[model samples]
Target chain A: MTSLLYKDWSIIKKTRALYFSVLYFSLIMPSFQNMDFFGKSFLANSYYIFIIYLLFSYLTAYDYKYNSDNFIPAFPVTKKQIVAARYVFVALTFAACLVLQSVVRIVILVLKGQDINIMNIMDYGQAAILILVFSLYFGIVLPLYYKLGYQKLRLLMIGAAVISGTVSSVLSEVGLDMNRPLVMLFAVIISAVIYYFSFTISVNIYKNGN
Target chain B: MNKVLEVIGLEKHYDNFTLDKVSFSIEPGYIMGYIGPNGAGKTTTINAILDIIKPDKGKIMLFGKELNGNACEIKQRIGFIIGENAFYEFMNAKEMAGIISRFYKRWDWGLFNKYMREFELDPGKKIESYSRGMKVKFALACALSHHAELFILDEPTSGLDPVFRSELMEIFQQIISDGEKTILFSTHITSDLDNIADYITFIYQGRIVFSRDKDSIMTEFALVKGRKDQRDMVLGSGKIKGMLESDVGFSALTDDRNWFFRNAPGSLVIERATLEDIMVHFVRGNKKYDKLAI
Candidate 1:
């Protein structure tokens, strides 16, 4: 599992796009200070929407880099372990992105003669939202990756959109908005639960073949 | 343990094609040539052996253990090259090797360096910049450096020039020279197999036409040519597996070469069948006898 994670890191780290995209987003993020969509605190942070899209691109590209997952089984790892390594890779990269972007943002703030409170630089609420998006998007959509080939991106995209849309409508109907403290806690719990179930789903799909 | 790799009654079904009860095995220290026409389940079989795809109903044992039972351990002992480029194109060979080394328990960096030096591959150069032959050489180096007990190479020499391909065949020979390793290489390039393969398993349209040792298969099959008028005599001989009726003459494949030698009419030419001749007749000859089970 550790070696597989190293492979994933090596794959993206060597590519110029990973650095370029992260740096690009870091510089452009503060401009969206007033960027509150889906009714304010529903998204305490929206920058990772770009990250999610880039993750998709990377997933598609890396799967292609591995010859559509043909060469993955050549290694000394199980299909389940391979999927777990990917999840770990995702988590590690997200943490790295968070730290790098935060550090860059801090340097920019200090250069502009701003105060040095970490809390002031980043919203704790924003970090939690980032976690939610990470868990939610990956939990729901990534199993389809293991279940289907990358060639079915169009089908995956449509399926993802429909699922997310339906969830948003249902949440809005129940008045369980992210702005409410209890509702935010509930959303986090739900995402964590979905994340656990998603792992098993991905494993089964991978083991069973596409 | 006599066999390094054994596939028993392997079956995988697809919407369009199915691998039907495929069975073959490789001894501990021999190179097995897997020859087949396009879309004839060569890659599918390789995938099943490596556990890349689950067989609907079959068993694959590698290194004497069921592959599903001890996959990680078995995979650690096997190295494979399934495509033209099997590494990250953007990364240099050094970084790629670093990542690959971590995946195996017994990675030999010194041996890897030796191969890199011997193959004249610049370790710092990115794979995308390397030529196709260079890429294959790099892949071979990686496969060799791991000290793998088995090598599963699919069409490893398909696109190479004669020089590089010949060099690779020598490397393959050297790999099993110690008599501890085995190799199963699949290719449509039958000429390459004739020079080095110890055993040949020929498949046509998802069925095994024949699988036998190199010399035995070469001896068992013969290409016989004669005047077109002798076609009736050859047809009546009940020995022709497949025949091409051309304008000048008719060339037929027969397992009973000795029978033809004793019973040919005037002016019959008989020659030992090469692997290419065998495959060509199997596919391009009459459909009725193309799947002759020998």
Candidate 2:
């Protein structure tokens, strides 16, 4: 499993320049417009989610392009371990994106001569929402990729993105008070459950799949 | 004989194809040549053995242990090359080897470097720049570096040149020369096995035609060619397994060379069957005698 992580990181390392460029645009582009902190925060968070999604796509694309899906099984690793490594990868990427986004937020505030309270509760709430959205998106898509290879699941990925976007947008419009700590905690709990089940389903799909 | 690998009643089903209850075993210290034409479940069988594809119904025993739930442990003792689909294209050979080496507990870095130098593979070059032959060589380096007891290679010689192919055949000979390591080499190029393979397991359309000692198969099967008018005489001998007809003459495969010599027309020419002759006849020719047909 650690080897799989190292292999994936090696793949990501090759495309570091592209990923950094995406991160730059995702962070800086939202700050150019005249908007309140909440509005700017929302745009920056959305872009962060976009960047993570792009990274996920690149990871899966590399697997397909290099045919690692067929070869990795030959290694001394079980399908369950392979699937678990992917879940761990996503979790790590999510944590890294959050940290990067926080850094960018602080930089933006400092440039604007605004006060920086990096531990804003509302920011945590928003991050939790992003986590829920991403967890659900990956939760559905990873299993599909295992059951039907990347080529066959391309349309399904697009459909999943659309559905995730629509559902998250609707939840936001409903004016749910994500600022509440209890709400954030509930979201975290739900995402964790969803992620756990997703891992189980992905393992089964990969084990039984061709 | 100690069986290094044994597969029984392996089955896999797709919408268009199904790998029936195929069975075979390879003894230690020998090369088992797995021969089949294109789309003949050769890859499927190999996949099942590696547990890359889940079998519907089967039992795979590798090195005297069941290869089901203990895949990670069993896989460590086995090395495999699945065609040209085994490397990360963007990483250099050295980096790829590093990642693969971490998965095996007994990875031998010295052996890996030896193969790298021997195969003329540059460790710094990325795999995307490699030609097909280079990629295969890289895979071989990784497989052999782990000190695996059993090697399952799927068309390891497909894209290689003649010189390298023969060199690889020699390498296989050297691997099993220790009388401990074994190989299950799957290929459509029958000539690759003619000189080295100790056992031959032939599959056609998802079924095993035969699995036996290579020398036994060679001696038991014979190719007979005769004039078109003498087809009846050859067919009446009750020795024809498969037959093919052409403009000038008809050729047939028979299990018994003595039967062909005794009952065949005077114009008929009987010769020993090579692995290629047996595979081509069984796959392309019409089956006239199901009694002898595997």
Candidate 3:
């Protein structure tokens, strides 16, 4: 299981564009709050989610591009295990970025003698909400990736990420109070259900070659 | 397990191509050559065993365990190499080998390094920069390092040069010479298997044409060359599987070699059929391959 995630991580690091994207994102991630589109923190948070979706897409693209997708299944891992590992990797990538961005933000603020809220409960809640919402988008689209492949689904993944990210952000701004501690908890349960359902579909599509 | 692999009543249906009840098995410690023409379901069968594609109606057992329920466990004991550059092209031999090492429970880095040294491969060169033969050596290195009991290779020697192909055959021999490893080597290069393969499983149009030991195949099949006058009798012979003909003569494959040599006219030429001839005639299809128009 660790091997499969390592494979993805290795591919991500080897691809030049993706490696640079990781660097570029981490540098800009600390400032996602400074840029806003419609609602306060809309572009900031939604763009982060959108970029995460793209990073995941690019990783999948690289695998398909390199023909490693063909050989990955031949490894000593089951399809279900591969699916589970991917889901975990997605969560890990998001978590790692959040940690990095927070550290950088804290350092920048300290260097400027500004207030530090890096470990604020509200900030963690917002991060959790973003992950739940991101999982909701991934839950619907990842299965399609297994079916149609990375090339055909690349545009759809991007377009869907933008639209879904926008709609969720808009919802949080308007009525849902998605930032509420209670709603964030609710989102977690719902996101888990979606993740489970999507994983089952992805595994079936992959294992049966549908 | 007595059998390293057993595929029973295997059937996969596509709109245009269907694997119809494909069945074959390999006992432990034997090199089984899986020979078939392009689009003959060789890859499909290999994919099924690897669990890359599920079979519609059949069971695949590897190392005495059902593949459906125990694929992860069964797969650890199996190592495989498909086409060249199956590894990521951007990664060097060492990088690829390092990642592959994590997949197997018993990966031996020392053994892998030994193979790299013997193959004369530079560990730092990316796969894209390596020649086809070198890429194969890299893949083989990774496959062998895992201490796998069964090795499933698909067209491992197809794109390689003749010298490297022969060298690869020697490596394959050493792998199984210990009587502890098994190989299911799929390829159209029948000559490579002529010297190394203990058994041959021929698939044509998604069906098993013949699956038998090389010695048995050599003893049971014969190539008969005869005058036009004797063509009818040879064609009518129940033993004939496939035949090729010319205006003045005819050549046919017969299952009963002794009977063919004894009963054939003194003027006829009869000899043991080589593996290449056997595959060519079988792939050509029995009567469809005949040149009676001549």
Best by DockQ: 2
Quick one: best lDDT, which candidate? 2
- Steric clash pairs (candidate 2): none
Number of colliding residue pairs in each model: 0, 0, 0
User: Tens-digit lDDT track for model 2 on A1-210?
Assistant: 998888788878887844784557555655542465543344444554556566667788888887787888889889899999988987888777766666667777788788876354136666667779988888887888787887787766665665565555555546455666576678879999999999999998888787
Candidate 3 lDDT tens digits, A1-210? 999888878877777655676677767755666655577657656666776786787778777777766678888888888888888887777676666666766777778888875243245455556767777788877888888988898888878877877766666566543345566567677778888888899988887773
**TM-score of candidate 1 chain A against the true chain A:** 0.73
Better of 2 and 3 by lDDT: 2
Candidate 2 chain B minimal-lDDT segment of 10 residues: B285-294
Where does model 3 exceed 4 Å of error?
A: A29-32, A35-37, A117-129, A175-183, B285-294
Candidate 1 residue spans exceeding 4 A from truth: A35-44, A65-68, A95-130, A154-189, B288-294
Candidate 1 contains a number of clashing pairs equal to 0
> Using TM-score as the measure, which candidate wins?
3
Give the alpha carbon lDDT tens digit for every residue of A24-73 in model 1: 66766655544555544232234454455565567667767558378877
Between candidates 1 and 3, the DockQ winner = 3
DockQ of each: 0.65, 0.76, 0.68
Q: What would the per-residue lDDT of candidate 3 be over residues B93-153, giving only the tens digit for each residue?
A: 8888878988999999999999999999999988889888888888888889978999999
- What order do candidates take by lDDT, descending? 2, 3, 1
Candidates 2 and 3 compared: the better one by DockQ is 2
